[model samples]
Target: MSLPFILFFVFALISVGGAILLIMAREPIHSALALILVMMSLAGLYLMLGAEFIAAVQIIVYAGAIMVLFVFVIMLLNAGTEERTDWSKIAKYAGLPLGILLLLELAHWMAHSLIGRTPANGAGSANVMVSTRELSMQLFQKYLFPFEATSILILIAILGALVLAKRDE
Candidate 1:
């Protein structure tokens, strides 16, 4: 097998394992760490797909900044282990079947969509290298309004958070 194929499997396994651990961990801190592992593995997969800029953004924005924010909130809140609740029998029985059905549906959709599609390679591939300047130009020129709106929304959220936090003190 090719090196990329092997690396893909490795990253996929780590990502899946991390997701499982994130769900299963009782402690909030451990779950956060597991999420970080998942994010990093996803970044690796993005890198293998030739999306270096996306991979770097995934690492820097998600794994670094977002995770720090999550960790800080967890610590500030003094979060503890999750409390277990008894599951109703109907939910216990129905949830598994429903989840399996959803998984099967997704798999069928993916298989149908991918069956006739040829993987792109060479110059025709979608993985063309784009310069940061071109990317910034597109972002600022074409997507400027949406980007600024998003920033404004984020600023509002931050201000609301500060107000709530100050109110609590």
Candidate 2:
């Protein structure tokens, strides 16, 4: 087996385990830590796929900035361990099968869509490196509205959090 394949499996397993941990953890802080582990492993996977810029953004933006915000909110709220809830019979019986169906549909769609597509390299190679300048141009030119909207949404979330905090005091 190739080294990259093995590394992919390792990172994939770590990410999946971290996701499970994130879901199962009772404490909000522990869940946040697990999410950080998942994000870092995803960054490693991105690096393995030759997306160095995306990997760096994943680590810096998600792991560093976003996680700090999440941790700060958790601390500010004085969040405690989660209380166990009893699941309804309908959810318990139907949710898993519906989730599995959704997963299978997604897999089918991805398999069909990616079957014969080569990486966007003109030379038909897999290691196409997207320059930062090109990426910025695409982001600013094509995706400007969506990007600005996302920032506004985040700002609103921050303001909402502050309002809730003030109300509690």
Candidate 3:
């Protein structure tokens, strides 16, 4: 009924619908696009929750960079639309029960959280990385080595890809 609740439902529906479409889409590219819709809707939900940094990361990293990578890989592989196949009885029947269970869990969580929660004026104390100061402090002081290690790992992966592409004849 309230604005925030309405917005939450809107974004939640968009995210869930996108996820379903992503799974149902036959083409790899369409699936990737559907995933982008899900990611962007999740970013909206993050913004609604006052997690600005996470929302930005969701948009920039997952929707922007990762989706681009997914699209590129799909194109590079020349992936085609999936061929329709007969589904097993177990798989077809199992989906409804699983969906209902997930729905019940989500309803329980929302009922608890929305009933008594007040909106924080800004990112709450528990929200790490809400500001650049905390993020930079942790990044440079605490997690610097891991950050550099991941960068090195990415470089190695790029080199491996190049090597594989230019294999000696």
Candidate 4:
């Protein structure tokens, strides 16, 4: 196989392995770290696929911002490995079946819909797509409500965190 092909496969494997670790790790901090790794691997995959903007966004928004927030929440809540052990047996029983069902549904969707779909030609090219411009336009215009709603959600999350952290006066 070509070098690029090999690298692609390796990144894909790393991404999937990171996802598994994220799901299976007992410690919440470890899971968050694994999830960060998964996001980084996915960003690498996006780079390989020529989605440069998407790769950068994935790294910045998901790997940097989102996972850092998750790690902060875990530390702030003082969640520890002890809580993990308490839920281990029941979680395994519930998680395994749920994971199996999810895998089956994903496979079914892939087989029926994704296998036959051809990727849009020139879709990843910066000059051809101008995706950032188009996305900004949509965000400010047609999809403004959804964008505002997401902002509101973030505001609510901030408020909720403050409320949770406040000590009795």
List model 4 lDDT by residue over 1-169, tens digit each. Answer: 6666787788889889988897678789988988888888888878766667788999999988888889888998998874334557766899889989999999998788865475543223334433666767877999889998999999999999899979989
Question: For this target, which candidate reaches the highest TM-score against the unseen true structure?
Answer: 1
**Candidate 4: where are CA atoms >4 Å away?**
1-4, 23-27, 48-51, 73-80, 83-98, 116-130
lDDT of 4: 0.80
In TM-score terms, candidate 4 sits at 0.69
The window of 10 residues in a row where model 1 has the poorest summed lDDT is 118-127
Candidate 2 C-alpha RMSD relative to the actual structure: 3.5
Once superposed on the true structure, which residue ranges of model 1 sit more than 4 Å away at CA? 88-94, 121-134
Which consecutive 10 residues in model 3 have the weakest lDDT in total? Answer: 120-129
Give lDDT tens digits, candidate 2, residues 1-169. 6676778899999999999999889999999999999999999988776677898999999999999999998998999987987887888899988989999999999888866685542221235656678888999999999999999999999999788768553
Query: Against the unseen true structure, what C-alpha lDDT does each candidate score?
Result: 0.86, 0.87, 0.85, 0.80
Error of 3 at 39 (Å): 1.0
Model 3, span 97-123: residue lDDT tens: 898999999999988887557555333
TM-score of each: 0.82, 0.78, 0.72, 0.69
Ranking by lDDT: 2, 1, 3, 4
- How many Å off is the CA of 113 in candidate 1? 2.1
Model 3: lDDT equals 0.85
> Whose lDDT is greatest here?
2
